[model samples]
Target: MLIVGLTGNIGSGKSSVARLLKEMGARVIDTDQVAREVVAPGTPGLQQIIDHFGTGVLNADGALDRPKMAQIVFNDTNALKRLNSIVHPAIRAQLLKAIADYRDNPDAPLMVIEAPLLIETQLFKLVDQVWMVTVDAKTQIQRVIKRDAVTAEQVSSRLAAQMPQEDKLPYAQRVIDNSGTPEATLQQVRQIWSDAIDRSQAQAE
Candidate 1:
């Protein structure tokens, strides 16, 4: 299978692009979802986090309090690094397992792993290509504010915590410019799908 690593800065609509790729007949492993699974109640990942950050990081229902955790990490570089250290290994292991299972299935034609920190975590090395979704910073901030219902300052802080979009651009082999209308973005995705098919055929040859 031709594995594509999909990544983008916060509020860049990477999930929407991932869904479109699914519609084009690619199996997508969303790392965000896997990250949650690795830390669900009773998991070692959760225990490690609690041990490091304390029980205050857990919600009343005993689940990881994402908002509180975000606040803690976004405000402190060391905290963010510590959180990534705790969670990234588990997420990577699970992602590799999923990829192995997909490789074993004959029906799996294409695979994409949607990871926001693909470059930062050095996961792009695992894929055949990296596809990045991008938008203007202004558009990114607006979309984030609307979707997350957080203050502009809060959104800015979250965005600040990640590698800038400009820096990530050079790392991507392909770019999906999502600053335009949905129709325009869809056209770009279709082109990528067609290119991927051609690449797969060439590899078989």
Candidate 2:
């Protein structure tokens, strides 16, 4: 399989691109969903988090309270680093297992690992290519504000906590500009999907 790491800043429409790839018959392992699974109730991951951040980060059902944890970490660099230290390894392990499961599946010629922190977490190293989705800062901010229902300041702070788009661009094998209309973005995704399919077939030969 051709493993592609799909990443971008928050509100850059990485999910949209992932959806397009899925619609194109690519197997997409969303690291965000994997992140949640690793930390679900009764898991060692959640226990470790509780041991570090205390039980306050958990909901009444013993689930990780993501919003509360985000509020705590996004504002504090050390807290965010600490959270990543605990979560990244677990996420990586799950990703590797998923990749291994699909590696020999003939039906899955392309596998896209979609993650917001692909570069930051160094997960891009596992993929054959990195496809970055990008949009203007203004559009990014607006999209995030509207989607997340948070103030501009909140969105900006979260964005600030992440690696800058410019810094990540150098690592990308392909960049998808999502600043335009949905149709335009879809066209870019289609081209990338076609290229990925060609590359995968060549590799198999």
Best by TM-score: 2
* Residue range 47-142, candidate 2, lDDT tens digits: 999999999999998899999999899679899888888889999999988888887564666889999989988899999899999999999999
Residue pairs in steric clash, candidate 2? Answer: none
RMSD of 2: 1.5
The total of clashing pairs for model 1 equals: 0
Model 1 lDDT per residue over 28-57, tens place: 999989999999999999999999999999
Cα RMSD of all models vs. native, in order, equals 1.7, 1.5
Worst 10 residues of 1 by lDDT: 101-110
lDDT (C-alpha) at residue 64 in model 1: 99
For candidate 2, the per-residue lDDT at 147 reads 95
